[model samples]
Target: MADEPKTPVPESPPAPAVAKKAAAAKPAATAAAAGNDAKLAGRTTTAAARRPKKAPADDDTSPLMGRRGWMGLAWGAFTAANAGCLAATGRFMFPNVLNEPPQQFTVGFPDDYGIGVDERFKDTQGVWIVRTESDYTHEAPGFYALFSICTHLGCTPNWLSAENKFKCPCHGSGFRPTGINFEGPAPRPLERTRIALAEDGQILVDKGQKFQEELGGWADQDSFLQT
Candidate 1:
């Protein structure tokens, strides 16, 4: 017995259509994920490229000096060496010379001296002006300039007024006031220098001309000044 008629049920979509839609959604999601991954990779590559590269720890480069600094040091050394060489050359070119006193000079007038040994010119002129009443070698009353140098070794002899002699301090050589060597190692009498009157009336002594008693040079007219 059919009591009532049953309601008709709605038909579901086809499995193929559902399957196609799901398949299309899956492909779109996969494509979106791939695009994001590609963007991230690109960003990472850009950042890495922008970063600076670091030098190796084993590098031999010096922090304090560069190539220019080394070159400057070499140039400075070269210049200093050249300067030293130039100085040596200059010293060789201009040799040293001795400065000696003039050979010819003039001492004062004859009236300024008295009889006996006058030591005024001993230290300065290297001569002793002796005014003798009678010279032993010349045998006359006049003035004679005796060289203060000893004949033995060229040492200077001092005049001792108390002893009335010229004594050589080096070897005990002795000479009378008349310039005659009497004791010690002296080979001859004290030599005399050229003595004359200048045009101005002042006595002029010339050390350039020497007179030796042994050689009869003391007999020369220039060796003695007759008062």
Candidate 2:
């Protein structure tokens, strides 16, 4: 067998000029990258400086809520409570008039009820009676007999003699001497009654029927009492 000859390693060719130039520029490229990073960092810092800081809605040491806001909340609660209370109280307490109003009710002659103003008759039905001065003996024949119901509300009415009017106890409705509504929430006059003269010369009023705008209450002298 012939002795094996050893193969020698081939020598590398000389680097190209362009390749050497690229190697030399590596450091400059790295430096340029570092400079670009530095410039980016500076720009970031400038932008942060230009942006405004966020502030709080209220003073630094003050509470988040204001006094007015608290007071408004409190008043709203109170008003709601008051309204509930009133609604509860008005639920009951009024009984409608029952049975027929009393009849054959006696009243004094006009001599007693004249211009003097509301002389509550001396009878049970006349609990809150008001009489005006004017003798109905042989005069112009104008008279009235009415229930003391308030025109504005359902409360009982009272005769205000000094003021010469009938006034409601509830909401201040008023009426004239002839039972005519004159003031306050009254829409009409106090209802007048059906009247008659009894045998004993006493005036009797039928409280059942209500007559409005009558010049004179029922009065027949000769047929006063039953035959």
RMSD, model 2, all Cα superposed? 18.4
Superposed model 2: Cα runs more than 4 Å off: 1-101, 109-113, 126-139, 214-227
Q: Evaluated with lDDT, which candidate comes out highest?
A: 1
The candidate maximizing TM-score is 1
List clash counts for every candidate, in order. Answer: 0, 8
Q: Score candidate 1 by TM-score against the native.
A: 0.66
lDDT per residue for candidate 1 within 1-227, as digits (tens), equals 86798899999999999999999999899999999888787356766888999875543387888767888999999999999999999999986987877666677887787889999889988999989888776788888899999999999999999999999999999998878899999999999999888899887888999999899998899999887
* TM per candidate: 0.66, 0.42
**Candidate 2 displacement at residue 84 in angstroms:** 42
Candidate 1 Cα deviation (angstroms), residue 64 = 12
lDDT of 1: 0.88
